[model samples]
Target: MKLECQEKHSEIRNGEIHVYAWFFNRNVYENNTNVITFNKIKSERSGKYTCVARNKAGFDSDAVNIIVTYPPIVWTKDITFNGINRPRIIKCNVSGVPNTYNITWRHYTNNNQLVRVFNNRINGVLILPEGETNDLVFEDSGVYRCNVTNGIPDESGNLWQSKKIQVKVEGKPVLAKPLKSTFIGHFNETSSISLFVLSSSNVTQAEWKAAENRNSLGHGCCSSTVNKTSFNGKCLDMSGYTCVFLIKNTREEDFQNYTVDLINKNGRNTFDISLISSGVPEVPSITDIYQRQNYIVLEWKPTFDGGAPQGFIVQYRKKKDKNWESIRIQSNETNDFVYISKLKPDTEYELRMLAFNRLGNSSFTVQFTTLFKGETKDVWTQFNLFLCIPIVLPVCLFVFLLWYRKVLHDGIVTMTKVWLLDTISIFLVTEMTYIPR
Candidate 1:
């Protein structure tokens, strides 16, 4: 704390100035006569301090109060445990000089949300200057922060240690996701089987056993025993427990369900994996399309069922458009045609056909086109014009001659008379030439 001169007038005005300062009713200083200062301030420096200035005119006085605040210090190390059957306690170990700060516990969830843990309990989270988590799970593993704040106000004050805590809880082995009842794999193709275990557990050995028929390859082909890691960026093992199985070449005899057995003193957990063939169905093609007043009918044919029951799917859209409308065939239906009603008139649409089964879908997409009622009428009119052109042209010329029959008869009579005169002249010349010869 510091105090300044409080004299009412300077000594230059012929009035001598003197100042006095003291902690209210505590200590006083007269030799300084103008200002008071402290080398260091602490909790003890709190309370009121008074200042007085004297002159020939009289005296003036003023007072001020000082207060100090500090945050609590905490440890930065992580709190860890081997396993939990009951509650586990973790202390914050915070210290404040005057014991003038409050303790608050915070739990950071897996989804990155902060929840206040107070009053010694909230679900699995408990708070009392220490954090206690009961029946911990893999989701409970995250950052925990212990915050402290004194009632005092200071701009430059702070805690002396780190506030973040990393908590790790170990427990029994549990699957991240349940295995499927059946999986599809191609013949003679490589396949992968992955299993994830949460944290560290009592299970020490993980083994895979093939069906009785495939006993020739004993112990099955399992590889890449990942410890404290994840597979394909999923099933992250925070406690280092994961196993993977890889088959180089699948065979028909290996189509049975394989069992994975995990053994330890605690007990044993087993899961079976069934494999099936993923054969693709044959491609389907659209054969015919008929347009009516309010709807269009489409027909398609599929060649083979690909060793399984097949279903057809029809998709269509406007010509040169980006969006498409789809129709799924029913599983019980055995026919190959579908009626698509409620269509716009005079519009052009492109259709696609394909077939699928439980194994896989066909590799090809058959494309076709459908014409609306007005568009079909335009096609028929063009065909009629071509068929009538030969017959109509000759009839049209005959009609024109009948409208001008008199002019046509006069011209024909004149041409016939001229031809007869020319013939006569040619005959006379020919007879004269033969006589001269």
Candidate 2:
């Protein structure tokens, strides 16, 4: 049965139009009580209406009522993609009514392309007792979405509901695990050590640390990551140096370390000295003092640091200057020296060099210096004979003399005289016994 709104012309008529109704399904109908209803109606039929007609009753009147019609909105777009070469669900929603509708699937690609996809109708009204849910899966791991709408509407009639969603996919790294290290040569006997690194990417940092025997020689090598997998460690063993080695990849954010200490011994010493590369500055030594020159050219023995060093840094200042001046030079090995030539001839300059590493530059380092013609004020401050004799030697000698006099002085005198008498008797006997020509 269906109930429809209608217009009435006279007053004394059936209570209302009973065109169609589920409530009026009763077989028996009262004399003038006609009511009708419909399970559904055309959305266009929404509006005011009046029922009319009169039978044996005077003029007919009408009562106006409205048929409310709300339709489900329609949507056409759906589907999207992600950056990882993967698919993902796009955030989307559509406005509509009846809340009960058939949701059809369709795909609208981001490239301004379209494709129609199909899934059986989703009768949320039948599926869910209350609300509706639209869940979608990635089609072949690419991208997709669903279109939703009811079969009818208020104005145009059929409507649609739809939204787009994206899907994603990603792959794993090439190497599954960390690389294992290989131990190279004789640990303690190597005069100089070298390190070689081979990697899948450019290395930014490289350095070595050692600890073994009783003394460990810290690195004195330039630290860098040339990363060829196989390169010289270029480690110089200091005197009495023995230790384990630890290689590091400073290029990495967290940095990866290849530690050999586990196979070696547990030591507290870390030989982390930076080596001088070719052209790199060495410990500065000045020679041939010149009185006429205000500043002296200081040279340092170049370093044979492991990696290529961009250059050397030299710092100096007049003995009276408030600040210091610095100079840089490019280098590649140890034993090379730099002659800082330009200077104020009369002024004394205190010079030093700082070594830079992946960790940062070494502090105001004294590894290098320029020889300066020192003022004669205290030429022998360290070798002052007066200081030793008056302060140290005298005090020590006085102590020894007192100890000697108090302890063995008497015994020494007696023993000496006795020995002298024996010598004299022997001489007398010799004279008496032999008259030689």
Candidate 3:
């Protein structure tokens, strides 16, 4: 294929004439001649081609569109439609040159017989039951094939392209197996438990209730209706035939065996699930510590709540003091940091942090020295130094000086001197160690 642009004469004159340049789809064609040639072209090369003649005064250009034609390609996928009572529309996706085409729909039956369902110029066909208002039946389930042709033949000389779709029509309500039957939740937290049902028709009525006892009832529950709006829990309609029982705020009493009853015209079914309590929360870790004026701000990252709603408790005390000051945070609070105000500057204080729920609590402890009123360095650095000194110094002194001091002093004064030198070296090394900011 080739494209050529001829120069046309005009009365207006330019300073100097230049060579012609060629372009395809707004991109420069490597060939700078007036004609663009292709030994063999594919569909991708079809687009607008332009030729431009330039001079010192200005430039002029012209363009022409190119198109490639191909045979029809039909695409289809298997579809499963629940609620057989409803009408459905089945369609095949087709793409090719010449938008106009004829579509043929055929069904392959269980007896190995081929039957033509529809033959028309439309892309899609509506499927209904035998009667105008009748419901679809299981006999409607089969392999439906769609053939499309636009009067164009492929390279292999095949005029029609075909695709098949497996249609399934189901009936009766049955339990859709759940991944797990038990859910762990915390008190005062929100939880949604889902129960899926597969049926040919919509679930006209659904009942969500708590069982008096799970051990006594094997399939059904004695109704302590939790689906009412007045209660803490309610039934929510979900897509894909799922019934969700949402507890807005779970309580200790809400942790029990639950049942979901699904009812349609054809049949009814029930499913059971259990909501259990979680254990104590994991220990909290201090993520950051800084000082502002006389106030110390401590930030911590909360750990897993063991499937329950949890809150934080911060306790702090002066290093020389025995009693601790406590600050409790509620679960609904969003603040991740606690501000300890009116603290003595340049004084070391021990801090204890714990996460607690109704179940129990876990705690972590650290020590930080407050910064001076106008100090810029953070309390985190001081905390790091304090952590090393208090822990290492006491343990080292107790093991080396207290336990072996008498023996060395009675017989080997040189050994005692060496031990004292080692202890001093250890203390200096610890003090010089890098402190976390």
- Top TM-score prediction, candidate number: 1
Give model 1's clash tally: 1
Residue-level error in angstroms, candidate 3, position 26: 4.0
Deviation of model 3 at 375, angstroms:
99
Model 2 Cα shift for residue 213 (angstroms): 19
lDDT of the candidates, in the order given: 0.60, 0.38, 0.68
List the candidate numbers ranked by TM-score, top first.
Answer: 1, 3, 2
Q: How big is the positional error of residue 326 in model 1, measured in Å on the Cα after superposition?
A: 11
TM-score of each: 0.42, 0.21, 0.36
Give lDDT tens digits, candidate 2, residues 288-363.
Answer: 3333343354545433332324345777776667787777764554543445556643345676765543323434
**Sliding window of 10 residues with minimal summed lDDT for model 1:** 121-130
Residue-wise C-alpha lDDT for candidate 3, range 282-376, written one tens digit per residue: 88888888777667789998888877789998888888899989899999998899988767767777777889987888756565544335445
Model 2 weakest 10-residue run by lDDT: 125-134
Ranking by lDDT: 3, 1, 2
Give the Cα error of residue 310 in candidate 1, in Å: 15
Off by over 4 Å in 1: 1-38, 42-68, 81-136, 150-162, 177-182, 201-204, 210-241, 263-269, 280-314, 317-437
Index of the highest-lDDT prediction: 3
Q: Give model 3's TM-score versus the native structure.
A: 0.36
